[model samples]
Target: MKHPYTKLLANIIAYAASIILYALNAGGSINGLTILSITLATIASINLVRAITTITERKQQ
Candidate 1:
């Protein structure tokens, strides 16, 4: 789908997957790589949300 919602959903799912993996791999304590991956994933999700919001706003105009 070309709709912004698609991007939003995909981003959310990807972020969730990364979070789950981090939790699984670094049970009690988080490792450096895990932290890095999670940080990158969160940034990616935020970017996706921003892009989607821009798309919706453009469509509205």
Candidate 2:
């Protein structure tokens, strides 16, 4: 029920990279990359939230 540190770290890096890419793309008027980065960040955020919730629920049980 414990959180996986490695997974968390990976997610953190992914999330950070996504944000940076998104911003860079947006600022530079790169439509395709901006959209892709946004999508990736959204997915990563959802997965991270889900993982945290699952770990919390398992601990409570």
Candidate 3:
């Protein structure tokens, strides 16, 4: 089955992977890429929460 938010889920996964990679590469240092990845991850997390809320609302109807 496919979910309406499949694309968003994929994007979130990609963002998470990049965040991990940036952290590993930085080796305890903060850089532009690390900051950017973190920002994106935060945005993606918000989107995911919205998506989950939408799904729950639909189920209640």
Candidate 4:
């Protein structure tokens, strides 16, 4: 079962990662946006992992 939102999830992960890197490089303070971006990236990563697992399971079955 292929997930329809895979591209969206990838984009979200990329966006969050870029935001985190930009913040780190800019020598800015740790604010809400930074925290939010980290959280979003983590969640997106987890979802992507789950999607992969599900696809593999389906293939095996």
Candidate 5:
């Protein structure tokens, strides 16, 4: 339960950083930064979803 909360916090931080990087990339031409940021954001969002699901399951149990 506590670890889930920590994971959620980490996911939030990662997601936020990725979004910031993405925004910065958007202003510029296509490059590795844009690709990397997008990829990281996607991964972070997925992890966030998983963390939320785990939390929910634990609560149900």
Candidate 6:
């Protein structure tokens, strides 16, 4: 989405889901599912940051 808030929300949700996965696998072994969530969360966070930066730059114009 172009809106920064939407990106931020998505990022938050992704992070929350990722954390949940980690919490679920908080024993000893790590699996692909947990790693996937974390990867998704990282991607979402990057997207969020990019959106926020662009949004601010647009506003500054």
- Note the Cα lDDT for every prediction shown: 0.77, 0.73, 0.77, 0.77, 0.72, 0.72
Predicted candidate 6 versus true structure: per-residue lDDT over 3-42, tens digit per residue? 6477567767776776866657784565787767677867
In model 6, the Cα lDDT at residue 35 comes to 68
Q: Write the per-residue lDDT of candidate 2 for residues 1-61, one digit (tens) a residue.
A: 5555658667677877777766876597556767787778777777877788788779879
Write down the worst ten-residue block by lDDT for model 2: 1-10
Q: Write the per-residue lDDT of candidate 3 for residues 1-61, one digit (tens) a residue.
A: 5666778777777877777776978677877777786877788698776979688779979
Candidate 1 stretches greater than 4 Å from native: 1-27
TM-score of 3: 0.53
**Candidate 4: worst-modelled 10 consecutive residues by lDDT:** 1-10
Across 1-61, the per-residue lDDT of candidate 1 in tens digits comes to 4864876687698767879676777686777777787778777877877887888799899
Best by TM-score: 1
CA shift of 37, model 1, Å: 0.5
What TM-score would every model get versus the actual structure?
A: 0.62, 0.54, 0.53, 0.57, 0.53, 0.58
Model 5: lDDT of residue 44: 71
Give the better candidate number (2 or 3) by TM-score.
Answer: 2
lDDT, candidate 2, at 59: 89
**Candidate with more favorable, higher lDDT: 1 or 6:** 1
